[model samples]
Every structure is written in C-alpha cells, then in structure tokens.
Target: MKRLSVEICVCTKCVMNGAMDIIEAVEGLKKLKTQLRLNSQVDIVTRSFCSGADVCPLVCVNGERMEHSNSETVMAKIISLTSKDVK
Candidate 1:
C-alpha cells in the first residue's frame, strides 16, 4: 500500500471559500483507502508561511499540487495517486 501525505491551510479566506469542507473531503478519502488498499494518511495542517495563500485553499497529494479544487476533485486526486495500476 502506498502512503499519501496531504497538506492544507486554515486561513480565513480559505475558510470563506469552503476550505474547512476540504478537511471533510480529506477524511472522505478513507473510503478510497479501503478500495485502493492504500494507506491514506492525511495531514490536515495550517501553514502560516504557505505562499499558496494566493491560491488559498490548496490541496496537495504526495507533493503534487491540485488547484481550484472542490471536494470531488480532491477525492479524484487521491484515487489517482493510490490506485496501483492507473496509467
């Protein structure tokens, strides 16, 4: 099973834009974890120095940045990363 590390910010702008819900989306990845047989270890954190604030509400899976994403987009990224045979 592959491990995934996710990072997010808790800035107010992000919150207003539904960044909090992003956390829920990350949690939702647990379902994919089971289906993909991958260990979905999500780290929902706040980085004061994150320059992505301009992009605000950023979601990164395994060091790859996903931009302007909603919950579903975030989930897709996780599934893509965790799936063993996806090309």
Candidate 2:
C-alpha cells in the first residue's frame, strides 16, 4: 500500500484562513478511507509556518505544494492521487 504524505500549514496566517478546518476534513477523510478499506494510508502533518503566508493556507500532497488550499480542493487532490493507484 502506498502512503500518502500530507502537510498542512498551521501558521497564524493559515489558521486565519481556515487551516484548522482543513485538518478536520483530512481526519474525516482518513477515517472514511480506513472504513472503506482503501489500500493506502494518509499521513498528515502540521507545520508551524511556511513561505506561503501571503497565500495563507498551504497544503502539500505527495511532495507537491498546493497554494490557497481549502478542504474541498485538498480532498479532491487526495482522492485523485489515490484513485490513480486503483486497478
């Protein structure tokens, strides 16, 4: 199973832009994926700050950075990345 690495910025700028909510969403997605028996694991990490303060919330998935991240968009990116591994 491939492990998906996720990073969420928790800087003041990020939280002010709803980064906390994104964390919750990612947790929810992790639980849902586990319940569904998906063959991959989501490993989420929190960051104190990133260079994307201007963009506020920044998310990184599989080493790729996403600017102006949001729950829906981040979730979609994860879904797309995981589904690509399905037979």
Cα RMSD to the true fold for all candidates? 2.8, 1.7
Tens-digit per-residue lDDT, 1-87, candidate 1:
345777665567667667778788778667565666655465555443345457766767667776666687887777667664334
Locate the minimum summed-lDDT window of 10 residues in model 1: 44-53
Candidate 2: where are CA atoms >4 Å away?
34-37
At residue 63, what lDDT does model 1 achieve? 70
TM-scores vs. true structure, each candidate = 0.72, 0.88
Best by TM-score: 2
> How high is the CA lDDT of each candidate model?
0.65, 0.86
Candidate 1 clashes: the total is 1
Candidate 1, residue 6: lDDT: 74
> Where does model 1 exceed 4 Å of error?
49-53, 85-87
